[model samples]
Target: MNTWRARLLPPALAIVFAAVLCSVVLLVSGANPLATLAEMIAQVARGTTAVDIVNTAGAYYLVAIAAAIGFQMNLLNIGIEGQYKLAACVASIVGGAISLPFGLHAVVIVVVGAVVGAAWSGIAALLKVYRGVSEVISTIMLNMLAIGVVAYLVPTFGELRGNTQGTKIIPDSGQVPGIPFGGAGTMFGLVLLAAAVGVGYAVLIDRTRYGFELRASGLSSTAATAGGVNSKRMVMSAMLISGAVAGLAGLPEILGRDHTFTLNFPTGYGFAGLAIALLGRNHPIGVAFGALLWSFLDKSSLTLDNIGVPKEIVTILQGAIVLSVVVAYELVRRRELAAEQRRVGRALGTAAAPAAAGTGGERA
Candidate 1:
């Protein structure tokens, strides 16, 4: 099999399997699966829907990349949720409190976000390295701590106008500009930032020495150490990079749309990012497609109630896709590994047979 085909086939088959399973589910629930699919297709065709999909995908792409960084190093930085929320809160407060020129203001806000996220994530990295703490536990605890911190600080320092509770509004100079996509449709300007991040991620992971070390460490820490790779440093770097990218997860909404961290500021992108990263197999391009597909399904679900189809059907489909794809990928990987071992064994046996025959003839 061609390498590319081998890589893609499992995911394609997984998607088909998931679709069929979802259709059966809908049929059992007495809904027209075909009609529901058609509605989803139609929703994607609308210009306004395109904007929403792109905007959501932009944020999701960042989160997925953040998760992918940790994944590449065999580290699970579940603290992305807390890292991003805390970053957004601090960034918003800083952006609103000070004034700077247009370009500088946006730069400062982004820097603040990345710094805050890295700082928060560093705690987990330190604990893992020094205290032998599991990142999963520490990050989860950090998330709760972040939520409590945000809850207290927002009401204390955040501005309040009637019922709307949020940080101070960012000035126009500090806000990111949007690109108009036909009338009544505007794509977030930070979509370009997300694309840039993707490109950088691809280059760093596929083209850099550091990336090679990171991947080596992920495959086996002991092996990597034997090859002169510092597994501890790699873990720390991966955690920090993951957190920094995670910080940007909320900036698309904050700078390009809402312009403030508020009670209504979106959550759950961190968890969604983890799923997208898994679905994409941690590849940059794959993650981009995963993010877009996930966002499209989420946005399309809004109209399901109008069509008398349950919105939860989309959730079922999404979950099924993730589960099926993961299982399929694992099975395919094992099959590939077995085949490679067989091929190597045959080659060795052939070589040994020729050498043994020569030696036997000499003895004769």
Candidate 2:
């Protein structure tokens, strides 16, 4: 209960702060901040929008949770961008290739996409574990490389979906098929995916030995090693699992949900995931809510045109929220470190004082 409250406070405060700051900015920009917020809420209530904000939120959740898992292990799988891309490509290509029944085809696409994502991500993990490459640099480079690979493969070999230059749109038989919501844009599949992420991530972090070791290592590498945990293995497993989660995001996006492969269907879900992970404090459950909040903000920002607010204003709001959260986290971390140092220093001082007193007594 206490833990839940503790996790909830930061985001709650951030939202309030963001609201006030946005209001001030809006007032200065000759727009009513209150009106802007109301306009956004009204749009959501009216269910008259070009995009499904909730569904997009689900997409961000998928990516953010995956990246958060990697972050927990002290590994920044910047490769999530590449991981999602490769999974989308591999799954779309392989899934469209098969002509199975509807249910079977959906399953095939999801599984294939996830596996492909993990496989692609494994390259970064392999480099870090074996070749001594930093995941940050490798993942970023690999993301660009994956993009090139996709361009080459799609134009050259062609997917079974009937593509001449790029892969063809997936057939109905291969689609995960979304349930109607509001105006038939939002899907029930999204709800299921969110639940699965929450449950799966929580289990991976709390119920597994790997999670325990990773947490320990994140806290202190030397202590983790002393505890007999194979730090290197933990790091590799962390990367692999993180990659797998990132791979899963592609399922609902390309192969499962869209049944199509476009040049860039993913609108920066990977980058958004990093922000979500940070905001949620890297807790799986917290991250879930964070994804929802981001999705709301992101989708509503488009509606700014209705109230005459510039799009850049919305971006500024997001930047402010991210900056505030980062600052708060750093401050909290510093205080904890300072407290720890004081405790250690006090113990050393006490031990030395007693030793000096004993020496004086013996000399007298």
Candidate 3:
């Protein structure tokens, strides 16, 4: 019961708090909060909307897992935005330029994405380990740099074919096949990839030696160092792993839909991934739920304009959830710590009672 409470309570409270806050915001904005919320909820019954939610949740899941990896080692890898973009762009170019057997082609593109992402993220990791530079600063700068690089390369490498200008169009052979649902639409094939990644993440973190060292380092660097865990190695490994996953975050859209990377590809996934990671408490299962909830809000909010409610209300609600999760988790942690201390104190007192009585009897 306690374990379940610890696992579920923070998220539950956070969602409730976010709901109340959003209701107030809606009222202040002269919108009917309940009606607006009901409309969003009702959209889930539509097959197309359901497909969009699943597809989006899959992408968000991958990103959140990426963020969770670095988070596990206490490395703030804010550059996933850049990592995924650069990787997807490069992968698209490579994928489109080459022709190969069907399965081999997709595998090659995915590998290229992972490699490019790791290489980009390694820059920050190397700086942090060797120069004592903060990854937060390095990653933020890298994001801006990535944007310039992409802008320069896209127009240079990409030819304007028809109205759309992007890298060479990936041939059908390189595209990931989608799973069709009659009225819902086809789901991204990479959604399965996201599931596989989540399972792998859980196994690696809970069952592997590397995961132990990573967790140890996050909890206390000095203690980890004393225990013979190389802090530098763990940091580098964690960041690289995180980047590799982030690289794949864009592949769903690229392979399943766009079949190429455009200059105006989606952005902000990196920061959203961070928020989802926190909301999920860094657990793979928890993150999956968080991603689904996020995707639902995002996809459903599209019709808010029709209902005379600002879609930005969803954004405000998401922000509220993140804030609430942070504050609630901290409070819960403090409460648990206090309870633990009291239990230990009582145990010590009980253990000492017999000894004290024996000593007094002997003295008498």
Candidate 4:
């Protein structure tokens, strides 16, 4: 019961806190908060909207996992957005340029994406490891550099399709089909890929020695080093792993839907993923919930304009939720620590009681 409470209470409180705050905002804006919320909830009853939510959540899940990986090693990989875009561009070009067996073609695209993402991230990792440069700064700069690189490479390797210039369209053999979801739109088959990545992330964090070192390094680099863990190696490995996964963030859209990378490709997922990662406290299951909630707000908010309420209210709500979750989690952590201390104190007192009684008896 205590464990369940510990796990559930913070997010529950956070959600309620955010809701209340948003409600106040709605009232101040002269909108019926209850009605606006009701309309948003009603939108989910539509099959198409539900499918969109799940599809969006799947992509958000992958992005959050990528952010969580670097976070686990205390490295802020702000370059996930750039890493994924560049990877998608290169992977799409290669995927379109190749001819292979069905499964092999898709595999090649995925591998190319991972490798390019890792290579891009490796630059920041090397700088941090050798030159004592902060990853935060390097990654921010790299993001701008990636934008320029992609702009230059796109036209060089790609042709203009209509008005949009992009890489060649991938062959059918390189694409994965979406799963039909009744009357609703087809769901991305690669949502399963999100599930697989989540499982792999959980396993890596909970079962592997490298995961242990990563966590230890994040907690305290000096302590991890003293325990015979190489801090530099862990940082590089974590960043590479993060970038590799970040590379895949765009694959679902490319392989399942777009079949190519374009200038108009979706953006903002990297930053949103960072927020979701924080809201989820870096846990796989937690991140899944965060992604779903975030997606729900994003998708449902579109209906708000119909009800005379601004859709950007959802943005304020999301910001509130993130802030509330962080504060709630910290408070819960302190409470848990105090409770633990009390339990230990009581146990030590109970054990000392018998020893004290025996000593007194002997003296008597």
Q: Which candidate leads in TM-score?
A: 3
* Alpha carbon lDDT of each predicted model: 0.90, 0.77, 0.93, 0.91
Per-residue lDDT of 89 in model 4: 95
- Model 3 CA RMSD to the hidden true structure, in angstroms: 1.1
For candidate 1, the clash count comes to: 0
State which candidate, 2 or 3, has the greater TM-score: 3
RMSD to true structure for each model, in Å: 1.4, 4.2, 1.1, 1.6
Which consecutive 10 residues in model 1 have the weakest lDDT in total?
A: 1-10
C-alpha lDDT (0 to 100) for residue 344 of candidate 2: 100
Tens-digit lDDT string for candidate 2 (193-279): 766877888887899887788888888878999999887888877887777778877666564356666665665778888989989
Residue-wise C-alpha lDDT for candidate 3, range 153-206, written one tens digit per residue: 788888886776799899999999999998889999999999999999999999
RMSD of 1: 1.4
Rank by TM-score, highest first.
Answer: 3, 1, 4, 2
Measured with C-alpha atoms, the lDDT of residue 338 in candidate 3 is 91
Which one is best on lDDT? 3
Which residue runs of candidate 3 sit more than 4 Å off their true CA positions?
162-164
- For model 3 the local lDDT of residue 352 reads 100
Task: Give the runs in model 2 whose Cα sits over 4 Å from its true position.
Answer: 1-6, 48-51, 157-166, 182-184, 188-191, 255-257, 334-364
Q: Residue pairs in steric clash, candidate 1?
A: none
